[model samples]
Target: MKNKQWMSVLLGLTLGGFNFAAEAQTRPNIIFLMTDDQSIHSMGCYGNGDVQTPNLDRLATDGMIFDRHYATTAICMGSRATVMTGLLEYRSGTNFMHGHMQKSTWQKSYPVLLRQAGYRTAFAGKFGFDIQEVPGTKTLPVPSHDFDVWKGGEGQTSYSTKKNESMKEYADEYPHCTLSYGAFGRDFIKESAQTGQPFCLSISFKAPHLPRNADNRFNKLYKDKIFTKPDNFGRENGLHFAKQSHKTRGYNAFEDRDYDKDYNRVIAQYYRQVYGVDVAVGMIRDALKEAGIDQNTVILYTSDNGYFCGAHGFGLKALPYEEASRVPMIIYDPRHSNSGKGLRSATLTGNVDIAPTLLDLAGCSIPEGLDGRSMLSVYEKPTATIHESLPLINVWGVSASHALTVVTKDHKYINWSYAGENYEVTEELYDLNRDSLELVNMAQHPEAKETLKKMQKLYDGHVAHWGQQAVDYNSYQQFGMLFDRTKTWAEKEPFVVELDRASHQSVK
Candidate 1:
């Protein structure tokens, strides 16, 4: 295990060094592959031991992997909005860009800019913002005219055998192609290549998200891999900062009733689902090569948000911890003449950089009023730091109180505010040099006062820049408007141990 990890580290370093040597001779076709509820810790290239991700790892070998990449807000709509717009979610006026898509004020998304720039823009999988007719949200496809090829959001069940079972009516809202959803995105790539037009394709996978219900072929693929539990699993709540809203209940946090076997079972399946996504990535990448456009394509692989797979004993997302906030960012620029090979960058970056970077790559002028800056220059110089300290912000799913955070190379600090005042103030300071697991929260410790103060000041600056707003996460918490009060998988049905055992034995 140590040897494997060392080898991966060496590969990452080699890739990082290659960043500056590459140059783009041509404007590349861009394929942006984003997954739902994926964690950086689950990929082989990102230091996961159990997950098989040859495709993404190959991309890392061929491009760049960002070590400190993250989502500004760790929720579906907000994160996606940030990635698409290269702006803070608060700035977009759609901080909690979920369910109510039609009513949200984000009618003008970043993809619209790409569309105007003469690129064939396409979107697949999940489009953020809840369209469910509710009190606080407006109904029917909240007016976002972004993307030329908008073909995703098949809901929870599509791509699985049960794709038509659970959310049959819901899936009907979006166009359902007979080709597996991944292929649909690749098909767009093929069409774009044929049309001789530059394309921006967002292939969003609803995998490794929930229920761990991947296609049977993928589900049956890695049934025997052992999943090691995270070191910080099953944490006591009071030691950390007090989380806002009811979302941090027993279900989201680690359950005392769960044993090692149950936890591993959930995680192993999640990794397997990721492997399936990786396979799709490989297929698309291979297609790009076959079409002879490999060298002229820029592929970006990332996720919507980080999910805690038994980390901090949490089953759901919505936390500021590294496990739930830090996501994997892989940028494979085949046209980059300097370091076309894998490059590892430790610079502080976020989804907010995505829009500007994409627009910049296409030679399109970035729109004014964007809080994010293009990192194309930094990509050429791997060690060049663009963001000295990046802001990480998130609001509660149940209420309006919001958390403002800033993460630098050395420390992390977060502040919770409610009702236009400091309702609950807590801070965390970690020396990434020593505590990778984040077991020690040194915010209140007198010995770490200076570091905490620095982080606090940075956090304050971010808060002042972004400002306070009645975001959706808070609205869901305080008003329950965006909150989906449905029973969970465990709540809806008892765990059938017999069925799992039978399947396991049969596979063995």
Candidate 2:
């Protein structure tokens, strides 16, 4: 199987006629640490005074911090798919709630690319996406034989190793899953160092996600703390879709219990889980240092998607709001002496850029047909703009809550489609420069009509460029029960493609 995989990789390289054999030897080791459902507001480095993230703050101090990073799709599976394949969720065909990542797409992912380039690759912690399991269909195991080391679990893995009955060997000294994953990471780092090969380790932690469980050691950290609600915590000034969600989704943080009690308890537990992830980060960093490769290794820390801690009266993610889409990203390269340490870059970047950036840094030939460009230049030129605008999509199956949002540095425009019909749309416009909290929707404002037109044109262009052929929404509707709220995915209409860019000119 390994030989066959290598043959396919060689064939691909030969067909493309690109080689990086010479540059591969000097490439720096890569460590990508990702947390589940962690927002920038939850991190100390990003100026959240309530949460304690000493390790992540130190990581930012050692490297560059990206202030305007976002996820193309603000959901776990879709965002993870984007980071892995460098493609939009619609293009990758992995946008559904439950399905395996197609093998062809998986082959082009960073792990496979780095492994084929003579770098040892390892993946630990939660492998976010799940494989489709039809009775007669063949499927690969959770961490599918692609890496030299694979210590991961499917779906939302347990917080405690004792609950994870299947994998005992990978368990750490403590029963916590974060520590267990960290143990795997440390072992892989040591192995890579002993072998004298450049390594790429991807750690995806399942912390601060749903069912927010924290270790007992951190139970007292925020027990007496009074968590403040977001300024837009209730239905006030929120979009209609968000307000409707609050009415229909009873399990959401806003609807589950008393707002004050639930918010404080959940927020505390969420912070505790984040603290656990921080401890894991410290462990991985110490392992890198102990292996004597800390300086040569590049450490990247980010999240799959941002979670709302009672922002806009929303508890979970999957919205195009800033709290749901904006994530924390840090790139630490110890060898970058040209710039001073601890630089903060406000360039607009997203999860899709991760694949291309890692491949570019490793001197590998990035594949064609990727939606994102390498952000390596942004690190060199902090003032440069990687993207003028970014598209945020939330089309999960046949969901009526689907939205298409176009975001620039200064503004955000959203077009919400009801029942998968493009014609039945509700628009929202926010000048981020003036209303950073998105308290005011300027879509109906007479003075903002021109801005709304420009944003719509941009959204139309993105749809034409990245949209896929019509998919059978009914076929995937069977998996709707796997999602959080049934109402969000109950609408069974097929997606409507936007008008052609050539025919639909911008409204000047």
Which is the leading candidate under TM-score? 2
Candidate 1 similarity to native, TM-score: 0.78
For candidate 1, which ten residues in a row score worst on lDDT?
476-485
The TM-score of candidate 2 is 0.84
Per-residue alpha-carbon lDDT of model 1 for 315-387, expressed as tens digits? 5666667877889988877667645566798888888888888888888888776777777776798888878
Candidate maximizing lDDT: 2
lDDT of 2 by residue, 1-508 (tens): 6997687678558645323333334789999999999978888999888889999999998888999899999888889988998887765556544345666677888999988887878887778775334311455677558888877777677887866654467555767787777777888888888876688999998887877678787889989788766677765545544332333342265666445356777788888999988988898899999989888898889999997777776767878888889999999888787333779998889998999999988888999878888888888887888788998877653344666788988889886655333334467789988887888889899999898888878777666555232222212222222121223423423212221121132111
Clashing residue pairs in candidate 2 (N, C-alpha, C atoms within 3 angstroms): none
Off by over 4 Å in 2: 1-25, 131-138, 165-167, 170-172, 237-252, 257-259, 338-340, 419-424, 468-508
For every candidate in turn, the CA RMSD to the true structure comes to 13.9, 8.2
